[model samples]
Target: MDFWEADELAAHRATARAWAEANIEPHWAEEQHRTGCHQTMELHARLARDGILAAGWPAEYGGSDVDPAFAQAIFDECAERDLHVDGWTTTSMVLHTIAHTGTEAQKHEYIPAALRGEILIALGYSEPDSGSDAAAAKTTAVRDGDTWVINGQKMFTSTAQVCSHIFVLTRTNPDVPKHKGLSLFLVPTSAPGYDLQPIHTLGGQVTNATFFTDVRVPGSALIGEPDGGWNVMRVALIYERGVSSPSRIEKTLAEDLASWAREARRPDGTTVLDDPLVAERIGRIAVDEEVGRLLGRWTNWQAAKGGIPGVEGSMRKLFFTEAEQRHFSDALDILGAEGLLAPEAPGAPAGGAFEHGFRAAVVTTVYGGTSEILRDIIAQRHLGLPRNRPGG
Candidate 1:
């Protein structure tokens, strides 16, 4: 009826708490606010050394080399502290692809450095014209003797200004179907003709609009087989979602909401905790948050056993994102006018978390994949429904 961790894992979470108090807490949020990024390499290396950064990966590939639960316990430590790094959550996706599908030299070139925090790569999948329909990418990769010349523009690149490389998806063959013609490449940020401009987000952070003009990387930059990039995206997104999460972000956020409300007082000076309606809402959030963890745990167990589970990623992402939006919106309603105050405003409730989270929730529904798209995925792939309907 309930989920509880083993005593050892609880102790591991406690160690993570101490680690945060000593290293991450003092500098992390200020750095993120200052540069629109939270990319402290020293801190990143610390996480990697402490076996937190690797999450659930195996030892030979530079992972913390622990089982998924231990890795997740560490991740929770970071989330509770509000600690973050721009690309740390995603770097392993790139590493896993390299370790599995890359040539021996490519594996040697990327994986170790990535694990050591010397190299970081952003997911260069979304484009200017593309949001959910990722298969329609128009960026092209042309072979020039031993080099592949890349020309394309990408949007929603969260860590472009700070990362060392981008794992780009490009069209290598235009004549084939849109999905089959794509390829992925690991193009270093140092390559000439690469440009990035900032895109400010409602969440008070910066992502980027990145352009590649005649950016050249050797044939060795390719990951997996040519025309097989779609599969690479498929693999990467499973990790990007909560299946391999270090700290279970959505669950933590939901928990924080309940904690904030307990201390929040209505204009009548009674704590929100004393109000039955607020109690009901908080109880609903707790239920949904628990459901999300159950979904993630089931799928994460599958990932630990060496497979992506059956559509659990879609289910988890869909429920948590939608719930995140609702949780903040409901908090705003519960907090009355004080909830609308800006973060750090003198009268703001819970340090204006509701206003900030309300804005952040807008992007949650769109990123990774939209709720509409995930619904279709569940309907078709998970439920075995017809893909195309004739005048539904």
Candidate 2:
């Protein structure tokens, strides 16, 4: 894999960086100041209007039809500036799957509007009893004439409070095996019987517990063939797990730590950064960041070649999340008690970003998929090992 971006991507990155500085930088601190999920419709629309939101999508779907790397360039710019695109990320995952598997009518109705940032979709996969076992969903959707009546709950439904719809996984045919009985739906959050309550995490992020009590959606809401949701979900998870864009958190943290260390002094009056141990730890972080970036680039390259990343997604996901955990631990240790300070606290290093990141990194290993589960996937799917779970 090329360590450097191609000329076209490099030029695109320059443009994206300028756009982010003008549009995102001014408001970024305010967004960060807020406790959780701070995406706003104004910013979302601006991203679309600037052609950054869907740059890699097909031309008919409000995109420029450039290589997928173009979209990744936009993401890298945002991350370098500490701009949160969680809302767009989840929406894109669902939209990508829809573009591939949805009916023509469904495509016509949702695609353009979503790209224009008129609608947002939240993931509704985890249930109270089904954390990593998404196929074991108990959320039922029963067909009644032309409508489907849904009744159940979804946990960790991030962005539900602000999203227009939820890409839900429901048990449509419980008589069949767990994975075979499922279906997917694009349920409107505005519909009656739909409700959500917030779930605050230590990371200062807000997810939700969503409830559906006889929620009725038209047949058009069905994303793919009934009992074929597992396959549809696999596609969406590929987008989620795959390193379509590299995460800059670890990189940012290391930079911040180095900056703080440069200004910090030891009791002996020498700079903390002058210490060999501190330098070695930061060096380790840089190495990890580069490896993770290359892994992401490999997966993105596959997508650019019109192939969806398979177990390679699992590999990147596992490596990146675990590396993130390790990076933060090292950061906190280097920063000492001052590192634990919250953002608003006086004299906090890098505005307490490392502190908040330390907390935030805790969930990276849990969401999307757990580290343990990802390892199992890598073993069974990538390594050709027998399934560790029973009855496999």
Candidate 3:
């Protein structure tokens, strides 16, 4: 299929741009740097009012499904304005997962709330030991009459402190293979025995370490069939990795660095752009950005065509994240000491944003899926390479 958008989708892009320019631009810096849960909730509420959040859900559910590109367009538009929606990314992932797999009652109850920025779901898949290997989750859930008792910890669960629900991946049948024995549940964050501790990261976002101590929930809380969460969780992963909610912030990030090179002075009173290596670094990042963008658009196209983006998802995540790290690091190198300044630091280049970006980019490699794991997946699935199991 052609990657180019039709006239209608292009109009959605214009609408997204107009909305971001009007509503998000004036507070762009604050919007980008706000780290509080309350701040994020308010941001999404504004996005919902602007009709930007959850555009893929049905209109009856307070969502607009007119265009598959609508959501990604929002990402791109906000990025241009330097608005940060880091929390929105995973929340959108969880929403999409629910859209695909939830029961009618679950859909009616949760989807509309999410559209209005009312509730958020924290993904409880990875543990201290099971980071990339989510299937090795040791979080146990045992059925007792009509309730399921859960006990264990989840690492890197973002927004759990603010979320009303924690969609947990638990082991319900240890007798079966690790993947086969898994189950999914939408455990309330206020459940009697649940706990959340904020873990501050270099990225400036606070993900959580959630603990479940005999947390009990009704059978209705189960997302899919018991011991059949491998499939359900896989769908969530696809959304996490494949869904490209455009944070086009990086697009201008690279462009701004290139623009700065002309004005930036070297120690000897020469323009930084005069350095061949500096020019080359910016050139390389520009190319990487283009490639990452095309790959994302291609994957988005595949999803719109009603196919699960398997290898293509891995491809986009791998290239885009690695490219992100490269962009930040290169910008830092080019900016030198000025790049190390904080956003509030006086005379800080790019308001020291690339320095902040450089630190955050380290985790991007590990988020969604690790670069190493994604490479292995692409090799096995796309390159038809022999799969090598770790610790097999």
Against the hidden reference, what TM-scores do the models get?
A: 0.91, 0.94, 0.90
Sort by TM-score, best first: what order?
A: 2, 1, 3
Ranking by lDDT: 2, 3, 1
Best by TM-score: 2
Q: Which residue ranges in model 3 land beyond 4 Å of their true spot?
A: 3-18, 25-39, 60-62, 65-72, 248-250, 390-392
lDDT of 3 by residue, 198-297 (tens): 8888877778899999999998888878999988888888877786455523465568888889998888999999999999988898888878877877
Cα RMSD (angstroms) for every candidate in the order listed: 2.8, 2.1, 2.7
How much is the lDDT of residue 140 in candidate 3? 96
lDDT of model 3, residue 107: 77
Top model number, lDDT = 2
Whole-model lDDT values for every prediction: 0.76, 0.83, 0.78
**Per-residue lDDT for 42-154 in model 1, tens only?**
77878667666655555565666655556566666666655566587667767766665688788877887787777899889999898788888888999899989999899
lDDT of 3: 0.78
Candidate 1, residue 181: lDDT = 89
lDDT of 2 by residue, 214-313 (tens): 9999999999998899999999999889843444322455677788889999889999899999999998987888788677777877866767887888
